[model samples]
Target: MATVTTRTVEYPADGLTMIGHLALPAGVERRPAVLIGPEGLGLSDVERRRADALAELGYVALAFDIHGGRYLGDPQEMLARCMPLLADPDRMRGIGHAALDVLRAEPRADPGRIAAIGYGTGGAIALELGRDGVDLRAIGTVNAVTTGRPGEAARIRCPVWAGVGSEDPIMPPAQRDAFTAEMQAADVDWRLVVYGGALHAFHHPPVDHAVVSGVGHHPRHAQRAWRDIVDLLAECLPISG
Candidate 1:
C-alpha cells in the first residue's frame, strides 16, 4: 500500500459544523479525488478507513459527515434526523456541495477528476449531487435507491452505479426498479448490482450498536461491492503515476 496521510476537516454545512476525514496519498502532484458519504448514523471509523484505503490506492479521499460531529447510535434518532432530510432534495444537495467544495479546494485534489460514493442516506446525498448537475466523473451508491425530483436525473453527467441487497426491505425490488427507471429515462449510463440473500446495509460491517430490522452484514457481498466500486472508479477516473 502507498503511504497515506489523514487529517480532520471542519466545514460549515446545514447550519452545523461538519467534521470530515480527509486522506491523501503520498505525492505532491494534484491527484484524482473521491468524496465518500457515510450512512445516516453518521461518519464513523469505517468510512474514515475507507478514505485511507482510497488514498493508499492513489486517490485523495474525503469521508464527508452527515450529522455534524454526532454519530447517532440510536436507530430512532438516526431516522428522526435523516427521514426528513432525505425528503428534501435541496437540503441533500447543499450538504453534498459543501463537501465537494472542501474536497476540490484541497491542494492534493484534482478538481476535474472527482467521484462521489456513499452508503444509505449518504448514498442518497451523492445521488442528489449528481441530480443537481454537479460535474462528477462517476457516482456510486450502496443501499440508497432513491429517486430524485421529476426529471432531475437527466442532469447527471456521469456514469452511475448502485448496489443493493436483494433481501433489503428498506430498498426492496420496487425501490430499485424506480431508481433504474429514472436513470433509464434520463439516458444515464448506469448499472445496478443486487446481492442475493443479503439484507439492508449488507455492505456495512457488523456494528456494536443496535440496528433497525432487516439490516445485516454479508461479508462476501460486502467485499464484492467494494471491488465493484473500485472497478467503477478505475473505469471512470483512472489513477495516473
Candidate 2:
C-alpha cells in the first residue's frame, strides 16, 4: 500500500497556512518527487487522489494548496479567488517557490529530481515557476493559459508537456500555436497534446456542471493526462526501483 500523509505549510508572503498531502512510495530510497498544484478550486479530493495514484506508481508526490483552506463550488467566487493570483506574476511565482520549498524539505524526496504538474490556474503557477528558473526536472500542465511574460519560455531549462482540449475556449488554437512557437524559439523541449472533443478541466471526474463555458470535469482526459505525466516524469527523472 502507498504511504499517504497530510501536513500544512505556512506561506509567509500571504500569511496563509496551506494544507498539503504527501504520498511516499512504499519501499523506495530517495525517490523522485512531484510537486502538484491544484486547480482553481484549490486542494480538493481530486488532487489528493492524483497524488495517491502517483505514490502507487513508486513516486513521492506532494500536492500543495495555493488557496488557504477555502473552497467554493460557485464559479464566480472561484474565479474571484484565483484571478488575482493569475493577474500578478510575481505573486504567483512566490507561491510556487514556497510550494517547491515544501517539497524539497521532505525527507523521502530526492531534491535533485523534482518535477511539477498543475491544472488550470495551478498549471499557470507551475509555468511561472519554470519561467523563474526553478531547476525542475520537468514541468507539465493541463489547460493552462500563458501570461506571455518576456523571456519566460527561454528561462525554462526543463522539458515541458502541455495538455489541452481542442474545445477549450480558454486555450484556443492560436494561443497554443503561439506557445509552441515561443517554446521552439527558446529551444525548450516541449510537447503539446490536444484531445479532440474534450473540454477544460478534463481531469476532474464526475463533474456536475456540464456547462461548456464554465467549470466542469472530464475523467477520460484526466486519466490520459495522468498517464502522459507518468511517462514524462519517467523519461525526465528516471528512477531505478
Candidate 3:
C-alpha cells in the first residue's frame, strides 16, 4: 500500500470556519478525489480514518466538516444545529461547495475526477451538491437519503448510490420512497440498498460517550455497505492499482 499523508484543513462556510481532515496518496501526481461527509455530529476520527483508507487506495480524500469544528455528542444539540441546515438547500449546498473547493485546491487532487460519499447529515449535503449541478462522477450516502426538490435532481449528471437501514425510523419507508421517486422522476442512474436489520447510523461504531435513539451500529451490514460504496466508486471512477 502507498503511504498516505493526512492533515487538518480549514475553510469558510455559512459565516463560520469549518475544519476538515484531508488525506493524500504518496505521490504528488493528480489522482481522483473523494469528498467524505461525516454524520450529523461532526467530522470524527471515524470519518478521518475513512479518508486515510481512501488515500491508501490511491485517491485523495477529504473528510469535510459540518459543525464548525465541534463534535455534537449530544443528540439534541446535533439536531438543533443540523436540522435547520438540512432543511435549507441553499445552506447545505454552500457547506458542501466550501469543502469541495478545498478538496479541488489540493495539488494532488484531480479536479475533474471527483466523487462524494457521506453519512447522516453529511450524506444529505453530498446529495445537495449533486442536485446543485456539481460535476461529480458518483454520489454515495448512508442513512441519509433526503428527497431533493422537484426538478432539482435533474441537474445531477452522475450515478447516485444510497444505503439505509430498513428499520431506520428517521429515514423510514416513506422517506426512502420519496427519495427514490425523485431520482426516478429525474431519470437519474441510481441504486438503493436497504439493510434488513440495521438502523440509523449503522455504519458508525458504538460511541461509548453518546447514545442516540433509533441509531445503532451493525458491524456486518456496515462492512457490506462499505463494499457497496467501493463498488460504486470503482464502477464510476476507475482506479488502477
Candidate 4:
C-alpha cells in the first residue's frame, strides 16, 4: 500500500461550513482526483476511509461533507435535512460545485481528470453536478439512482455507473427504470448493477444507530460495488506512469 496523508478542510456550501476530508497520495506530482460524497448521514469515518483508500491508490480524493459538520445518526433527522435538499437541484449543484472547486484547487489534483463517486444522498449530488454540466471523466453512485429534471441529463458528458440492491425499497425497480430511461433519452453512456438480495445502503457497514426499514449491510455486494467503481475509474480516468 502507498503512503497516504489526510486533513480536514473547511469550506462554505449550502449556507453551512462544510468540513471535508482531503486525502493525498504518497507522491508530490499532481494526480487524477476523485470526489467522494458521503451518505445522507454526512461525512463519517466510512467515507473518510474511502478517501484515504483512494489516495493510497495514487489518486487525490476529497470526501465532501453533506450536513455541514454534523453526522445525523437518526434516520428521521437525516431525512428531515436531506429531503428538502434533494428536492432542489440548484442547491445540490451549489453544494457539489463548492466541493469540486475545493478539489480542483488542491495542488495534487489534476483538475482536468476527475471523477465523482457518491453514496445515497451524496450520490444524488454527484448526479446533480453532472446535470449542471460539470466536466467529469466518470460518475459512480451506490444506492442513488436518482433521475434528474427533464432534459437535464443531456448535460452529463461522461459515463455514469450506478449500483443498487435488488431488494432496496428506497430505490425500487420503477425508480431504476426511470433513471435509465432518462439516461437513454439523453444518449448518455450508463450502466446499472443490481445486487441480488441486498438492501438499501448495502454498501455501508453495519451501524449502531437506528436505520430505516430495508437498510442493511451486505459485505459481499459492498466489495463488488467498490471493485466496479475502481474499474470505472481505471477505464475512464486512469493513473499514468
For candidate 1, give the lDDT of residue 57. Answer: 90
Q: How many clashing pairs in candidate 3?
A: 0
What is the C-alpha lDDT profile of model 4 across 1-241, one tens digit per residue? 7889999999999999999999999989999999999999999999999999899888999999988899999999999999999999999999999999999999999999999999999999999999999999999999999988999999998999999999999999999999999999999999999999999999999999998899999999999999999999999989993
Cα RMSD (angstroms) for every candidate in the order listed: 0.8, 2.1, 1.1, 0.7
- Please give, for residues 100-123, the per-residue lDDT of candidate 2 as tens digits: 887898888999889999998789
TM-score of 4: 0.99
lDDT of 2 at 145: 52
Error of 4 at 210 (Å): 0.5
- Model 1 agreement with the true structure over 104-222: per-residue lDDT tens digits: 99999999999999999999999999999999999999999999999999999999999999999999999999999999999999999999999999988899999999999999999
Task: List the candidates ranked by lDDT, beginning with the highest.
Answer: 1, 4, 3, 2
TM-score of each: 0.99, 0.91, 0.98, 0.99
- As a whole number from 0 to 100, the lDDT of residue 28 in candidate 3 is 72
Q: Candidate 1: TM-score?
A: 0.99
